[model samples]
Target: MNFSSDAAILYWSGSNINLNFKGSEISAILKDSDTANYYNVIIDDSIVSKIQLNTSKQTYLLASGLSYKKHKLQLFKRTEWDKGTTSFYGFETNEKTKTLPKSKSKKKKIEFYGDSITCGYGNEVQNGKDSGTGHFENNYLTYAALTARHFDSQYSCIAKSGIGIMVSWFPKIMPEVYDLINPNDPNSKWDFKKYTPDVVVINLLQNDSWIVNLPKNEEFIKKFGNQKPTEDFIIKSYENFVKSIRAKYPNTYIICALGNMDITKEGSKWPSYVSKAVVNLNDNKIYTHFFMYKNTPGHPKVNEQAAMADSLIAFINEKIKW
Candidate 1:
């Protein structure tokens, strides 16, 4: 059967499905046939459970131990497209089920832009080694998601593994595809008007620091028209990118953040560059923050992500008061 025909797709990290039912148990017919993926089963907007999606399982019980009354269920795909796509055939409830309209999201909304750290790459791995697989990824526990959930706000995560502000591990950089609906598809375009966040957080520059010093290929040079990337060049590129985002979101608060990686190290010079870019932009609404953290191997674990989230949440609370 063509599974995609009848089912709603949870294609990327942060994609989700919601339902309201009057039942004690709720289950979903889900399939993530290739790579490992994860889902956040949120019931009644309070109780949350992390479920692992695998090829062997066709039906996943999202919530079983619930009181027999009207309740709300939200299933969030906590893994990126690289982890694989999940198809939700439908929901199964012991009693009568009612389809819920996609409720209007919270009045407050936030969007995050970055790389592996924002994507929660390898965050679930117990070992520190970069295993280079989807099994270790769990975007649900990332700092970005944690902060949004803490505020009971809506969120969008436009992040991927090894992506940078100016240079990515792959061919595309954040600037080139930030407007795309599908992070992996070059032809896709996202309409910024569909949902505007009250605040925008930019946590890039990690990969640029690592890749800028290296020799560039002919294609890379042609795309950027810069063979030797200097500190000034990086700052200017970043400032321009922020301007582009501002063009789309004129009044939104923009926070340029760095670290939870080596970007905080004095020698890295990344934090300085980010600060300089925001200063050069000269927008009082745009701010810069540096996270003092160790450059852990692979990615940050849950506890580490929570620490990052706490710091961010504290700042947003102070600055935006939301």
Candidate 2:
């Protein structure tokens, strides 16, 4: 079965489409652009693939070798519009397929902001040494998404692989791009009224600490420009960023989160900066949480991500009571 029309376009982050069919194989017709985008391929209720859309118009095989029976498929865009946008031309199945009714909106909503950790970079790597990009990343299985699903809540993940609050691996910081519909383009602004989350989680500072503390990060330093890049500067920048978010969502519960990576000795003081920012803001609605650092060579795997989500779920339950 193949279906295509101009009315099948979905244009937003975390947008999803559902298909109900009885077939052994199915493929999605996607029209993509240069800036890589990702989609979650869920068979039944389990995610089986994190397909990357990096080409022009093409037909990508989603799943195959399944038993011929009635099954449900979920296609979700994991990356934001900043990376690029793709169109779901439709799905091709062995048997006739029909679109399923849209799921009802959840009562609770969450917004996660961070870097690769929150993006689930390298989460699928089994060799522990594989490190490039794409393929291994799966935002659908990320701790943030998992936690949202655990609570049966709707979620929006606004994250890039190497972004930070003060210093990113490149030039763009979260403050500069947080409100942008397209993080890659400064001109693209996202209206605050679009979607407000009940809880806003900030898991940042990892890349900032790593890049800013370097003896000579010429790239970041050059981008840092005239501002004196110091520990105080980092702390102040973080505070200002949080203040901006608080201003936007006055009633939203803000969580200052860090870790699941190094945070001891010189690095240990970083999380404190986030805490001090929340305290200085004098907001009772804001809180801080940290994940214990477990020595992992690469990004957290599926099991580790699950544990992270469990911790977050417990905290959210205690804090927001949702």
Q: Which parts of model 1 have CA positions greater than 4 angstroms off? A: 1-5, 45-58, 98-104, 216-226
Q: Per-residue lDDT of 61-160 in model 2, one digit per residue for the tens?
A: 9999988777788898765444556666767765454444555677888998888788777777788754435556666777998998898888877777
- The residue pairs that clash in candidate 1, if any, are none
Using alpha carbons, what is the TM-score of model 1? 0.88
| Span of ten consecutive residues with least summed lDDT in model 1 | 1-10
| C-alpha lDDT score of every prediction, in listed order | 0.79, 0.76
Count residue pairs with overlapping backbones in model 1: 0
Give me the runs in candidate 2 sitting further than 4 Å from their true place.
1-15, 19-27, 34-38, 48-54, 61-72, 78-85, 90-95, 223-228, 264-267
Per-residue CA lDDT of model 1 for 1-322, tens digit only, reads 1135787656556777778777778888877766577778889876467788767547778877677778888887767766766777888755455555666768988999888888888787786765556666777789999999998888888888888777777888889878986656677777789889999999998887777766665434644666677789889999998999899899999999987887777677778888888888999889887776766765677878888999999999888787
lDDT at position 50, candidate 2: 80
